[model samples]
Target: MNPRPTPSPFSPIAIGPLTLKNRFIKSATNEGMSAQGVPSKQLVKLHSALVAGGTAMTTVAYCAVSSDGRTLPNQLTFTQSSLPHFKALTDGVHQAGGLASAQITHGGCFTFIRERSTKRPLSASGGFNKIGLMSGMFLKQAMTEADMQQVVREFAQGARLARQAGFDAVEIHMGHGYLLSQFISPMYNKRRDQYGGSLENRLRFPRQVLRAVLDAVGKDMAVICKYSVTEGVRAGNSAEDGAQIARMLEEEGAHLLVLSAGMNAESITTMFGSSFPKENRVQQKNKIIALAMAIQRRKEPTVEFRELYLLEHARKVRAAVKMPLAYLGGAKSLASIEKIMAEGFDLVAMGRVLLAENDYVNKLESGASRDSICTACNRCVAMMYTPGGTSCVLGQPGDAVLNSQQAASR
Candidate 1:
């Protein structure tokens, strides 16, 4: 039996010009938690907690590129009005001893679902998003060449704004059925034009988005693409296909690849939601397993992460590309981090665990592995949809925001 490779979570990793103390990241989780499109005091407290917890870096999470992409009323947005807010958020994280990043995003056809959005949802092509369950309700407007060009411009501008805000990195939200992912997913993107059909054509929109972002930010700040490994469709997104997409993105100037599962179907079982075993078929396991095995058996480590179950994809991506990788979702303990490193991954990132236990990094670094941390009940996730702020329901505060949303809705 080969000695389990060096623990990935403890390894020092370089994300562009930034060198993290170790390979643990606070996966970007939108706090629903922000205030007026900027980082909130609670958010600063949260980042402080993550830094004190000992993670190498933490993210600002969910800084929307446009008003339409803003998921929650208080979520972060990158318009000129938000500059000071972003600056303070980044400064707080860095002061806490963690690198601060922004997962710059756009909602596409899916933004502001819980709210009565003024802007209409846009897709690569026309189709209803559940609201159109009755054909008539499934209303969707296909993207025109002009629309595509406009989108490319929007993403590039978002990246440029991220740098101005002092973020160490920018993560393009291409996973979990957001605007970018929708453009790539066969289930969401149905255009017959340059944006759809054939894998290359389907990928054009994402590739263009990446190029635009890179051009806007250059190499001054790290640009990471958070892509779903599967679209959870009968024949939509696939792991092998996803990695192939990763290869293409790397070629197109993506600085890092953040692999995840699921798409924007609103199914609780997609992406990180699959980790708790609360979900039936356990979607993320297989592809992540395959990807990890391929990377482990390789002679060189091309990709840079050992992140969640997707260590598999990271591995395969590593073998295929010379870029670094990072993992996200459901990592709650030091033991798990150690295990991922042993498996040869380069980093570990936690979303809810950090929220429930902000000092997670500190505790893990202090020799208390995250053995029994983060209940993952998804109360924090639920909080975002509620309004005001998001936190765990069973958490210490229970559900303040939930109560607020309830009161307001009433």
Candidate 2:
């Protein structure tokens, strides 16, 4: 007998040397469940539940390559000390019947400057970030050649560590205004070096990082890149540039391209899904910074919710590159998911909806209701800053009660 063919969306497919069970990936959403740059039991439990709930693969989000590279102090870091915890997390996910991926990241200047005091934050250029300055952080120092090469080495080392930790794949975060993203976006990269002139120059460091990661991991595990298609603001990466970037990533031997957009400093609301809720905003401890956030929040542009919001943009990327493309954006409801899958995207990456409904893929498989109940209110996005970690406010009613009870006791 012949082997079975892969199904669309539900089909098992090969990404590099790894085969995912289905075309559904739990996009890298901040879990805020780690502690002191180490994965906790809570992190393990979260990924396990997501895997058991029917995601083909659940990604461990925002694992930093180094201590100072983190956007938050509590993020997961791939380091000698963190090895066991990461291994446990991946082991638990695999035991739950899903492939596991780690999203390796470095926040660059956006690494939350307030967290580090010994040295200034690193950026592609030595300059002030308006958002950083507004938050009382001084100008970031430009990355020296040594600094750049060291970071590339860290990325490669992170990938190798992920493979050792039992991850089926590693997703390089090359988007969302993180360190790699800063080098790619002209908005933050103003250097005059080989790493910062035209698009090719802007791509220099990212390509180097990708090459190093590929060399480190070889074909042992899949290597995917989560990249922004555009910043969705003037003077940022345009659609054309995004397409070019996707093509470049393909040439660099990336197994998959997860296309997303928006620069946190540019139009944060676009990346964030909806307007930043005033109620959920963590009151800045510093008065000046609190005032700055208040002013910026009021001025932020809000994008209305639309099904498959980024499908068109992702389609452009699909056209540009032959590598497997994962489409991310507003994918809720059966109609929208089917629309996204039918558009030739190899996978549909869900974030907020999965936060709202962990078993959505199972629901799809079981011939149950086709529509997703997630409201996309984005309150969970705010919970990443809370001490309790990210939890759906409306989706999990029991969590709400537990939180309220905890608050009352405190």
Which numbered prediction scores highest in TM-score against the true structure? 2
What would the per-residue lDDT of candidate 2 be over residues 202-277, giving only the tens digit for each residue? 9999999999999999579889999889888888898789999998999889999888888766676667556666
lDDT of 1: 0.66
Deviation in angstroms for 219 in model 2?
1.2
lDDT values for all models: 0.66, 0.79
Error of 1 at 184 (Å): 1.0
Instruction: Pull out the clashing pairs in model 2.
Output: 7-11
lDDT of each residue in 292-315, candidate 1, tens digit only? 223322422222222254555455
Provide the TM-score for each candidate, comma-separated: 0.81, 0.91
Write down the TM-score for model 2: 0.91
> What are the runs in model 1 whose C-alpha is more than 4 Å off?
1-8, 113-119, 131-138, 273-319, 385-388, 398-410
Alpha carbon deviation, residue 260, candidate 2 (Å): 0.9
**Number of the top candidate by lDDT?**
2
Candidate 1: worst-modelled 10 consecutive residues by lDDT:
275-284
